[model samples]
Target chain A: MKAEVVVIGSGISGLTAAALLAKKGKRVVILEQNRRPGGALKRFTRRGIPFDIGFHYSGGMGKGEILRALWKYIGVWPRLAVLPFPEEGNENLRIMDSGKVVRAFFSYDRLEDELQRVFPGEKQGIYAYLNKIREISNTIPFFNLDLPLTPYLHDLFSPKGMSLAQLLMSLIRDTDLHAVLSTPVFLYGVPPREVNLTIHASVAHPLYSGVYAIDGGGQAIVDAFLATLAEAGVDILTGQKVESVLIRGNQVAGVKTSEKEIYASHVIYTGHPTSLLDLVPGEIFRKAFCNRMRNLINTDSMFIVFGAIDDPDTLGDLTWINYYNIRTGLDIMDLDLRHPEKSIMINAPGRRDSDSTGASGGVLLIRMSVWDEVARFDQGVREKRSAAYRKWKAESADKMIEQAGRLWGDAYSRIEPLAIGTPLTFRDKLGLPMGATYGVRHSMNQFSPGVRTRLPGLWLSGQGTLMAGIMGASLAGMVTVGEIEGLEPLWYEVRQCR
Target chain B: MISDEQVYQQVTQIMAEEFELEPESLQPDATLYEDLGLDSLDAVDMVVALEKAFGMKMTDEEAVRSVRTLADLFDLVCRLKNRQVTKE
Candidate 1:
């Protein structure tokens, strides 16, 4: 089979690129290893209860916002049913800091008011802290679109150039206030010490605008994108794993999948960039690039516990807003991989329809787990592990439940079959290398070339290449296709979309 | 006024690309819709491509509507370029 472009991985990045290219009259074929599409946006049902794997919630879906504009350009906006988080009360975040949990509201005045009550003496410092992030978020070229791209590159070196930790220290003297403002780092999967201030601000600023959950869950967004792809006549092949990228001389000739050899001039690999070396021509990819992809240190993986509550009111002090039950003095930079009670994120997911069992469901994400802990279980092989692995999985689920009970002051009443996702699960299921969340951590000090590669037609897209999350993946898709098509016209087109 | 020779070269190349046409098939008097199968989507995409290529906004609705044939498009582009030059 032959196509103009063969895109591997049916994640948001690959799907978006395929859709846009098809619209431009390119015959595109999308290959996904899993039976379903929507990579991170993929959601599955367990005992008739739907649980989202990567998608929890999103920011910037409000009218005329950057995320909204992007979705509109992708043709998924009109059908998307988005609901905002609490307008008051829990605000957006309840960050657990050292010796105390910091409460922050979405409103600037309210957040400032809450912080001022805690640190009355540091009023101006809080104001400066909030203003700086807002400035950094607004200045990003991708968000504004109309702004020239050159200024964004200079941001890492300009006055804004500094690790989030340094900036927070230089501005806010109080450690408690430092912890509160930098809580968004948890979402970025990076500690303040390593995260660039620019990246931290982009992830945080959207929170203040408002965080939103889709009415029908992430499945709705996936369906909408699928509909768009179908209408554009893009061929989507599922359960087809691309074995290797066929390269002749210096350019990508096609891809050999489990099913057949699909020929294409251009192959866009949206899977883990580190895994690309095994697939592509090594000589053409060069030594330095391959070495970097090989030697790159991935961020820590997560241990998630999906549990069901019989009633919503039964969830004491747990509003729809997510909470970070952080144990203060614990260095986020170096988390104790096991014993998740050290630093755990209790995500208060949106209420889904109770199954026949009649119970609401929520997730508890402990971002501490490491791959080495689970590597002992026969590698690359899943579900066929010994009784010891199964026993370990059960004990870990109970441990998370015990942690949650300590926080909520009540043993989970009528807990559902606790579904636990570990690093091994990420590696075996999601195709992440070390089950690394956000593959290849991007820092301001390092240079990660996005989309473009040394190979003529083989390109890279997805969260690993650029930023992480839905917006990052979507924008990465836009940038990759923009490179193929003219960036100027398409970039401006997205700007004028709303 | 911009030279007709310069306008023809630019117009032919731009139209050939935007409409996905062979340069040999493009005639001065050929209608965009009839000759190139240009539809509504093509018009919007063509307008964006032209605006980016010239680095000028296609703000005048009357000028956009007036162009029918390839020759009309060439004249329209020449007028717009001349207007920009006069303004500068």
Candidate 2:
């Protein structure tokens, strides 16, 4: 088979790149190792009820927003039904230690008022911090369509040394306020002490604008993307694992899957950056570049408990709100997996549906976990794990359930654990190294690889290349295609949608 | 403390190894883009290699952006190293 561009891994990034490239009159072929596409966006079913794995809710989908404009430009906006979260208290932060709860609103003015109300004496600091986030987020190129595209790379690297922790401390003095602001860290999987301020602002600024959940979860988004690709005449080959990227001299010739080889002018790899080392030749990349990719620190993984809410009525009006149940006295800067109860993000995926009944909705109790917790049981296959591993997983789930029950009373008491997922589950299912939830960590210490590679025709487009999450991954695809098809024209078209 | 000559040698060696340039070809005044054949992407990887080799953090964006020749990199590394020594 032959194509102008062969995209590896049919994840969000791969799908986005393939769709955009095909729309630009290029013959694109997507090769996915898994039987199903959508990578992390793929969902699972238990007892005939659907549950989202990777995506839940996102920011910047409001009218004229960056995500909205990108989706419109890609022709998926018409297919999606954007469900915006309530303007007041979309996310609730519950400090378990003190039993204090703070609400985060969608609008910046309302969010500021809420923060000021919660922390009585920090009005000035709250205003300054929110304004700073807006300022830094604007410096990013695609985040603001009005900005010039000449200094895209330079703008991203401008605020390199400053950490989120340092930035927060400089602006605010209250420790509790700092913890509240740091709740967004879990979304990016980086600690406040290590994550870059610019990266943090990029993730947080959008949410400050608004938060929204899609009507049909991640599966719907995947379906929309697949439909777009189909319309663009891009061929998708699932269950085909790419063995190696065939390189002739310094340029990419094509990719060789397990069954056969397909020739192409360009190859866009959307897997974990380190995985590329195994596919390409040993000497194709510099020793320093390879070493950097090998030593790149990954974001922390999760221990997720998927369960059904027996009765949605038991939860009352709190059913739809996302909860960040953080333990008191725990440093938000450094999260320890040993104490899972210390920090947990409780999400009700099914509650996003307007017609969701009590029995059909599902709840996900996700705790940030390190890979070491399940490393001892890594030797066995997914279906046949050791007895010790099962015991540990059951105990962990029970403890998490107990904590949730205590926090939510009778509503969580009826919650039954349908399945448990450790980092290994994420690794095997999502193909993430050590099951890093959000690919490479955007930290102060490490530099992530760029979209362009040392190899002439091999480019990278994934969460690892740019930022993390749906918006970041989608933008990464646009940026990679923009690099190939010319950025000014692409940006101009994207701006037209706004 | 490492002398200026050692810093120059180390920077040139890294450039030679990482960028596939000959050690003799790395002149002090040779332009990075035209002479050494390093593009914008190569500039990023070079910074990573230099940081790893010296065990120093190249946090100053302005200093890194100002590099156009081998001599500029040597001076920047020396200045950062001296600052690190003084801090200790």
Candidate 3:
């Protein structure tokens, strides 16, 4: 069926664009490759307990905060089940050298007081650092996914003037606090030095503002978007992977999937833009843009292990823990595969869940650093290598189980049906180029793709776009929607919602 | 010097306090999960709390791969602290 808009991939970006368009009374159809919606923002059931595969915790849930504001306008906030991280000992930063644990609480006053207690003389530095982050976060355009892109920063003193790493370094003297402040760097899985200060501000500024995890797991967020689209009368087809974007003359006519062909006026892809290149070549659009796509460096994918335990309360209530074993500083370009012991961040959602069922029923999340492709494994013989891969996965799971068992005592044995996702899994299942979790890494020289591409009526939105996380993807969606509808009028309506 | 049961008693108390398990219910050979029900996150917290209570520390990596039973944790603490006493 022909529709005004077709959103490929029911991830955050696709959901945002589709829901917004549908809300605006546009005929929209969303195509999701998975049987379920919510691409990376997903949840799975293990041992009858729902565990969030993606979106362990999120920032910016306070009343007027950027992400919360955007989500509230979209009717997502009201239905979302959100629980804040603990007031104290919420964000702990560990120094590998002294074994000193510095905790950053949700309360700004408490965080400041704790910093003073830990580093008596560094109070001034801490104040300046927090202020700089707050200021920088507020100035960046599309910070809330509602701002215009017109004012491309020529003003050097503006919030967009400095990179995130630069602003952070300017504020702190101690090396560990800087690393701790950038602890969330692993969330995007990029080095702190590479992350734009504006991105840091947008993420961190909201947390003191407030952070929350959806109680029903990541699926609730996806379901909310689905409900919004349904209410708007948008058709959604799951398990329909789009094979190609059918271009007619100079315009995007429609898309073809494994089972069916669907026609639409515009196709907005939520996956990596380059993935679309094979289906709809750059030669079809602009040759220069194709070269740009080929040249762009995709962000590193991750290896996540989800474990279900009966008693989650055994572990202290810490929403998330960013563990770095690296003794030195932070650098994205210096990610070394040979060095596996650097830092491994673990997020225990069961501890974070305010409405957790019981100590025996809570879930623990494991995220460790991994290179995109294990150099030894060959993807060409994947089908035949399934047995070998299973062996390796079991070996890997055993190591994790052994390590985890040390912590949980006998509760480690209770953890069953372990699911391991590698970069190859993302490549094979999600159709990501090189299994990149976030689209393209935003580099100093390289400009990540915008919502609009060179191909007329063809757009790119999602983790790969200029912005990387959920907030970033949603912003890209707004930008794409803005391009279709006049920006000023779009802002007028969105602002009115606030 | 504390007796073997006394050492076990102190260890169990810390484990119970940190992991929210009952001290009386915990046994020296009881697996944290198989018997008393402690998970990885709890294990890490227990190790940290043990260090805080005993004034010695265990790395997260060490806390994970090395820990198994309640007695295994007690041994680690004793070794890290250099308590040169044999188990009963």
Candidate 4:
């Protein structure tokens, strides 16, 4: 059967695009490679202990935010059980910087005050940086849904045009501020430094307003999307890997899956854009476009420790998310997982719905490294691994657990490791190219692909298309579908969504 | 009642698809751990896959410990389905 649109890869972007297009009365069928629908946001349970894959929490889910409106419009907000991050310094997500434990705050004002309190010597720099981010946030079209499209010239000249690293250095001479300021880039999935002020502002601004995690973790959002898609009459075909985007002359006609062919006039791809080279006929894209995509650096992947701490006291003390840098000298830049010269420490106790502070339990995602360290073992088969490689992975997890014990104090000792997902796990299980967690690296001054592709009907979406994380991926879906249906209508829907 | 051949085929398909192994490589007598080298995570995925494929809910988690061979899995699934059928 021919669909109005064939949405590939059922991540946030694909689901968002399918829902929106389906709402517009377009026949859409989302083809997911995995047996399950959620792309990065899929949650799984082991011995009844729940763990979220990509999704931890989201910002910009607050009132009047474009992300909030989009979620409501997509029927996601109502289904999701979201809560604010702990505002207090002790219980709140802690950042260990240069032997100083700086707690993160959800409120922008609170964050600023805390930063000022901690870095009293750099008061002027702190104020300037906060003001700069807010200014950068203003330039984002999605942030102010009421505003018309942010003009290209505005983008070229604004603070969004500068690198967050460059901007931070220029504004604050303090090294700690530089590391702390760019931590938002990790939310979008890059380790740090590569993210520019524009990408940084759009992705980071929401967290300062309010950041929230779901009650059932990412599963809640995925389940909501499934219900919405069903209600909207958007057919979902899981485990259907699109082998190729079939073309008729110069335009995209449809796609062929492993089992059967799905014909659609339009195809919105939500996977890593690099994978597109295999699907779309190579001749359709220009030489430069192909090369850029081929060499497009993936965002840094992570070594996630998905565990449950049953100790009620420790669990209560633990927060769901944190960017804990255990390594001193404040080198957030190079986290060499091999030598353990640098490390990213985060202790998130996976929570059961019964308790807020994860007294029941939760998960912590520690940034292991960029793909370089684990790329050697990428060729190994998933089901069967060489004993040597398996031993290495086991040893690595053991070391991380040991580090957690050191960094998090006595609470960490009681914590038991439930599951360890390495970069290889993501690459094998999730199908992310090189296990890059945030999709295509959203680097400053780099050429990232937009919604439109040279191939007429095949467009791009997902994290790579716009910003990273749920908000970015959702916006990207809008951008891609807007290319087919008018952007004005999406904007109108965004405004009208209550 | 499901035939032994039908049960074997279903078991083979689910295990093959889940593990990304060739179906022909799996024999009824072949051990899941030793022959297919299916690890702990792979076993979890296989169980989920089995539930979907056979449309029968596995009652006993202990079945995972005992279901070592493809034949063992076939019998486990058949028994689960048979129990459901009898109950229904």
The DockQ values of the predictions, listed in order, are: 0.01, 0.51, 0.01, 0.01
lDDT of 3: 0.65
Off by over 4 Å in 4: A89-97, A150-160, A190-193, A320-323, A326-331, A338-341, A352-359, A380-383, B1-88
Instruction: Please give the range of 10 consecutive residues that has the lowest summed lDDT in model 1 chain A.
Output: A151-160
TM-score of each: 0.80, 0.95, 0.76, 0.79
Q: How many angstroms is residue A158 displaced in model 3 relative to the true structure, after the best TM-score fit?
A: 14
Which CAPRI level is candidate 2?
medium
Stretches > 4 Å off in candidate 2? A158-161, A327-330, A337-341, A380-383, B5-9, B12-36
lDDT of 4 at B38: 68
lDDT of each: 0.72, 0.84, 0.65, 0.72
Find the 10 residues in a row with the least total lDDT in model 4 chain A.
Answer: A152-161
Q: Of the true contacts between chains A and B, what fraction does model 2 have?
A: 0.50
- Using DockQ as the yardstick, the better of models 2 and 3 is 2
lDDT by residue for model 3 (B1-88), tens:
4555565667777666545566677877888777886553244345445555665435334444667787787777666555534331
Write model 3 residue lDDT over A335-385, tens digit each, in one string.
554754334445565445555556435444343434434535645524545
Q: What's candidate 1's DockQ score?
A: 0.01
Q: RMSD in angstroms, candidate 2?
A: 2.2
Tell me the interface RMSD of every candidate, in Å.
16.1, 2.3, 23.2, 19.3
Worst 10 residues of 2 chain A by lDDT: A327-336
In model 3, what lDDT does residue A416 have? 53
